[model samples]
Target: MRVGAHVSISSSKATSDSVTPPHENIANAVFRQKEVGGNCGQIFTHSPQVWKHQEITDEDAATFREETEAELDGPWVIHSSYLVNLCTPKDGLREKSIDSMQKEVDAAARLGVEYVNVHLGAHTGAGVEQGLENAASALDELDVPDGVTVLVESDAGSGTKLGGDFEHLATVIEKADLDIDVCLDTAHAFAAGYDLSTAEGVDDTVAAFDDEIGLEHLKCVHLNDSKHECGTNKDEHAHIGEGYIGEDGMNAFVNHPDLAEVPLVLETPNEAEKGFEWDIARVKELREN
Candidate 1:
């Protein structure tokens, strides 16, 4: 059960602990993960909304690595900036995306993080073939460090977005010169019309993914329940078992032998005072042996 939430690394968000100077730095994420009863998790180096990248002091990076190694079962992932569009055909946007990803991977190496998660982004009328080519070429430009791997995440199939289909994921991996992997977002996959709302649907979707992209390339699972119906293409996430992918579907997905060892990171929304702690507990409960 390598499960955790996408915890914040910002020092501004104080921890729930009574200790003074709580949530001091990025290392605070280690404490935050424990607070929510999570063993592994994800974080953003800075605000994903902005283009500015935060510089991590060597001390901060070392402390984060040391504490995480000592306190938690870790394979921490750095989620890249939301603005990065590796699929964009526009020259300016593509260059910025490459630059942003380069900094993120460098940051990952510094922090001893194992993976950098990112979306393939919208094709924006460039069409699927061109967008995939653009993404592959863009990834080829990155000099990813020895320990870190970039994971292209699945997307909610909206407008001209890519990575929603299993074929899209397979294509990117096939076309890219640099070795890469994937992070399958449950909510996004559901929105993209991969039915995950029933036991049968779960089997079919898993088989489809294996057939198209190969399960070996799936390094992570963003386990979330979708707010909308199976094919709605909506990206909102609900609590673990309360949304369309309800108790039965979730139980089947979590207990499936093929996914037993894959890390599950919750991107579920908070409501009624229920947050990561509640969601993590729910996931553990749903997962039988």
Candidate 2:
């Protein structure tokens, strides 16, 4: 099973014997993943809150690629900025979202990362159909690099956010001119009313996904446990097997035959005592051969 966590790429001096000195480059993401016993993972090229383009030097890009290939069984994904609202009705916000996404895809190409993940943000007054159209149009504007594919992540369905339903994802893929894929966030899907807290629920959700959005489009899974109940539309992630989607649900999810090939990148909280390392190990333990 390919599994990992979202790791930071910031520079820091050596803190302890167990920790390596963080270099002032993106390659530190790879090192951080290795330290946490992850084989594949996700990274933010820049701060996710702000709309900042990644200024990766050629040297840093080269180093990142070399280190990733040599040290990890990787299909690293670059998570786009939080402010990128492809579903926005306003022109200025839509244009900025497109620009931010383009930079993210280019950065993914430079870093040899295969996927660039983004959310189809809140529609903000536009109806569901118009929101889907806006999202597809925004995605069509990007000149995506070769080997770098854009993945629209499933949302928690709060307010007017798109991608909450499998239908929204399928609609965007049908409407978009650009070739794209989907990343199913477990917590988000559960929150969006697709129950995944038991083996039967997981099976039902997988079948629904296959029926609405083809299984072929699922390239990755944002493996997480939800803090809220099913259909709550909340997005807080909890430790594996310790949330509403308990041990039974997570076991079913990780070991599902249909999802066997998809990479699992965890965005679980980094709290004391149980962080990415512990989460990754727990996932491995849950996987049945």
Per-prediction tally of clashes:
0, 0
Which pairs clash in model 1? none
TM-score for each model: 0.97, 0.97
For model 1, give the RMSD to the true fold.
1.3
Cα lDDT of all candidates, in order?
0.91, 0.92
Q: Which pairs of residues collide in candidate 2?
A: none
- Any runs in candidate 1 off by more than 4 Å, and if so which? 15-23
lDDT of 1 by residue, 170-224 (tens): 9999999999999999999999999898889999999999999999998899999
Candidate 2, residue 38: the lDDT equals 94
